[model samples]
Target: MSNSARILIVDVEPHIRRLLHGTLTRADYRVTEAGSARQAMAEIEANAPDVVLLDLGLPDRDGLELLPLIQQKSKAAVLIVSARDATDEKVAALDLGAIDYVTKPFDTEELLARVRVALRSRLVADGGRASIEAGDVSIDLVQRRIHKKGEEVHLTPKEFAVVAELARFPGRVITHDKLLAAVWPRDYERHIEYLRVIVRNIRQKLEDDATVPAIIVNELGVGYRLMGVAG
Candidate 1:
């Protein structure tokens, strides 16, 4: 395996593991395979990968049960790759700290793209600098500054905090509760309107058009995601 980026495929099916290994290897990612939750844990402890493609139907244990354990042991990003397509299952995985979810029979290009996004998020999280860039927008966490096209873009402190939080995870969705708890004091955690207002203000300053936004997109009723960012 090359050192470009390590990806662990946690699927019980040998053919599925082989398929993912080939695809990821061709794309320059080092691949590891785990046929069960126990093996997955061992692999994670022995060598933490940059991203984990987890299948929920592990033989030794339910994959969701291992999500937090994985997070506790390593900084690798968890991306659920399962055949279970229930909305509740997706929400449960995301709520339990999985960064992204991809159902079985997924498109190759889409899966690759999601993997790229997950890797980018992991890189940014581990990079130690809280700064991130998306297209023309640049966020400086240390300086608490934002610039668009090399020009400074002024934002309220609250608005800047919101953007900064979103930038930390880049392309991943930050749920409404997570953003609220992160940005506001405990007493204001339920104030979803505050998030909405701050997001609106951020778009007005950072995006070309707030109406048809391209940078920060709403995940319907769930949360918001920072789009088009690279690691």
Candidate 2:
């Protein structure tokens, strides 16, 4: 809700830019507008915004191609605001590290909600905190300790590493490759069974019922997500 949060809107249409600028300005966000991918890249280099609203259709290049560049330039969360409705496009963007996507003619309220969520995720990721809390689970990042319901929950070092990585982006899905690389940097090709075991152990320690997990939810063939803090 801070007016200091910077948002960059990248779209080729003048009317769309004006509409988004007006809406976001009224909502107390500092917004920067870019009409092309080239301009967006330049803005990112000059000063990275907190969040980026990118449209796939650009006069210079495909917006998807610019995703990695943007990510490399800054820690800004990218939200695709394209008119393209193809499922493949959405999947591609999400896989490429986009936090979320919204099609054209999007409802203002929903868009704002998504932006808030993205901002929250960024804050959690960027914050230099010694601990994190979600649901009934609390993790001490410094001590590498975990507790559930105020009771100590033991976890192996590997298990703790996996949980810590997922806890950084609560409510957001982290791809298997990313998780794997984070936990097993040397053995990138390690079988999925290793991750499965760690996840199961985490669930048993944190969830009331491992069979019906509430803390860590698995995305079939994709990755895992830690449920967000309760509202």
Candidate 3:
């Protein structure tokens, strides 16, 4: 049962770690466990796994405090499997690069699903998966094409490039400046209107409720994030 994906499960509870280790191993994933933040750091250094299941309450330090360190150590996707589910904590964890947050007393199916999504999202980010299809929308990277319900949805090169760049960083925010630079190239220093127009067009085509989007979410004054779409 050897899948290509490797996961690191970090928790102080031996029982919980064993349960997760068993489940993931059975699902054909390579699994490793760490009982403390220090140990987790060492594990991360030793071999960067594809995903990390992290608990916020660590014996040595709060998981939030170590988030940056962990991210720096590996390119693995981070999923918070902590007991804390407060709105503030969820927001902060997301802000700090966590792909998803699962609270303690969690359902096994839900946790597994979140882990799957995180892994899939990471694949898209790392360019392992180049195209995405959800419902009537499809984004093709090789051809630089988008389709809606089997029909070609034409977008300006700028608009298509912007969407492609944002799509690469699933569940992560790409700031306005970053988008501008990636899409507009040399004109990024001056043109801001281009980004706004392109984003508006993307929302109109992809969203059922442009006012309250379900796919591309505007992060206020920041930039944008691509949310998981049902495929």
Candidate 4:
């Protein structure tokens, strides 16, 4: 999180946006606004805001569904600021990696305080895994380390590259050509066997049962996808 702390406000109401925009800017914080989930995602990708003030009443998609997608792309701390005020909604938001859940009719001072805490909190400062989590397995992209059930699991450079490529876009099929290009830059598609071997090795080390793989799933003739929760 930067010192200025860029904040992205995602809400449909123009009055709410104007209020937040004015309030945040007055406090010396850089702020941006979005009217829908699509716009919110675009702003997040373009600006990489330090904290996201999300509303559940998005015009396009539910804020809950957008939370993980935001996690997948950046290390921004999410703050659910919504009118729902439901216990389940709050719990769900927290579980999805939101740092704070502030109701719509909140005090500006309290909201700002929470944002300050979020920027300083371990969740943003230490940056809890800007990678992917599969079951009990964790793939730390920054550290280039893989952990299964809280135990360090080692892999060769090529194997790590294979896993890292899958980690880059979890739950999406990465083609054989893409994996091959990432790991074996000089080698042609003929080197796909190498990728397969490396994936097999990764499964052996990380999966509970390599025979019935779960963490990394094969895409048959295509390539592979990491079945995990993106951080």
lDDT of each: 0.84, 0.82, 0.80, 0.81
The clash numbers for all candidates, in the given order, read 0, 0, 0, 0
Q: In candidate 4, which residue pairs get closer than 3 Å at backbone N, Cα or C atoms, i.e. clash?
A: none
Candidate order by TM-score, decreasing, is: 3, 1, 2, 4
Candidate 4: lDDT over CA atoms?
0.81
Q: Total clashes, candidate 2? A: 0
* Residue-level lDDT for 165 in candidate 4: 71
Number of the top lDDT candidate? 1
Q: How do all models score by TM-score?
A: 0.56, 0.55, 0.56, 0.54
Tens-digit lDDT track of model 1 for 1-231: 222457899999999999899898888777889999999998987666778999999998999999999999888999999999999999999999898999998887888899888876775665434567888898765445689999988887567767867887789898998888656745646698989999998899889888999999999999999997867
Residue 98 CA displacement from its true place in model 2, Å: 0.5
Name the regions of candidate 1 deviating beyond 4 angstroms: 127-231
C-alpha lDDT (0 to 100) for residue 48 of candidate 1: 62
RMSD of each: 13.1, 12.3, 12.1, 11.9
Per-residue C-alpha lDDT of model 2 across residues 1-231, encoded as one tens digit per residue: 221457899999999999999988888787899999889998886655878999999999899999999998888889999999999999999999999999998998899888877776665666534467878898765445688889988777678768867877767888887788766755745678888988988887888889998889999999999884554
lDDT of 4 by residue, 1-231 (tens): 122457899999999999999998888787999999999989987777778999988888999999999999777889889999889999999999898899989899999888877665623354333457878988765445688888988788778878877776778889999888766755544477788888889889988899999888999999998886645
lDDT tens readout by residue for model 3, 1-231:
222367999999999998889888877677999999999999887666778999999999999988899888787899999888799999999999999999988888888888888877776667645577645577765345688778887777667767777767656789988898766545525477778878898888877778887778889899998776443
Candidate 4 deviant stretches above 4 angstroms: 1-3, 122-231
lDDT, residue 215, model 2: 84
Error of 3 at 104 (Å): 1.1
